[model samples]
Target: MIREVQEKDYEIYMELTKEFYESDAVLHPIPESHRKAAWEEVMRSKDYVQAYILEEKEEPVGYGLVSKTFSQEAGGMVIWVEELYIRSAYRGLGLGKQFFSFVEREFSSMVSRLRLEVEPENQRAKELYEKIGYEILDYVQMVKERNAER
Candidate 1:
């Protein structure tokens, strides 16, 4: 079952996120300090970022966090999937797809497009997104690391 995440689920969510980042070959593992801050932001920014928990027999087994963004080009709001994780034990059961479908229904009225970023090496996730109709954007994402000491 999928439901809105509550305050009580934070601890479990943190643990699951940590495990997912650490074990998953694609994701970059974020330090616990950074994860804590990000988690706090998700809890506080209910209007912008909303989290949902996937439960099995009343226990949280997975989670998804999505944020709303305005797109002038699309003339409406778009939903950006910031995070999605399912425990290793619970994977391969179509839970991820179900969670995504739930999100699509939940934001059908406000969302013009659903977007998510995946690491280039994460072919499984890419295949899943493609199966769900997400296409790779034509532009490449570029980044530069800033050196504070300089």
Candidate 2:
């Protein structure tokens, strides 16, 4: 099951996020401060930066973080799945697919698109995403870090 994140989830959320950043899913380690800030932001605004803890048999196994934004190109709201990490042990059990289904059930009526990014080298994730009908956006992605001096 997937549920909205609550204040009580701070510790586990940080733990899983630490593992996620350390794993190949991300390009670099995110400082704990950033993770803390993210949690605080989520807690502060229910309308943005949504976070959910993924559960199976009533136990937390993973988490997903998403945010939404208006997209003229998409014709409406685009739900950007910023992070969806299932613990390595829980991976092959179909939870990822379950999470996608949850997204569809919960937001299909309101959202124009569901989007995410995957590292090109992460073949397993890419395959699963493709099987789920997520097409790779053929565009050059770029970002400018706000804290370049760090």
Q: Which is the leading candidate under lDDT?
A: 2
All candidates' lDDT scores? 0.83, 0.89
Mark the regions of model 2 whose C-alpha exceeds 4 Å error after superposition: none
Candidate 2 per-residue lDDT over residues 1-150, each given as its tens digit: 889889999989999898999999887787888888889999999677889999989888999998888899999998988999999989999988888888878889989999999988899999999999999998899998996432
**What tens-digit string does per-residue lDDT give for candidate 1 at 57-119?**
887898888988899987889899988888878888898899889989999988888998888
TM-score of 2: 0.94
Q: Which ten residues in a row have the lowest lDDT in candidate 1?
A: 141-150
- How do all models score by TM-score? 0.87, 0.94
- lDDT, model 1, position 61: 90
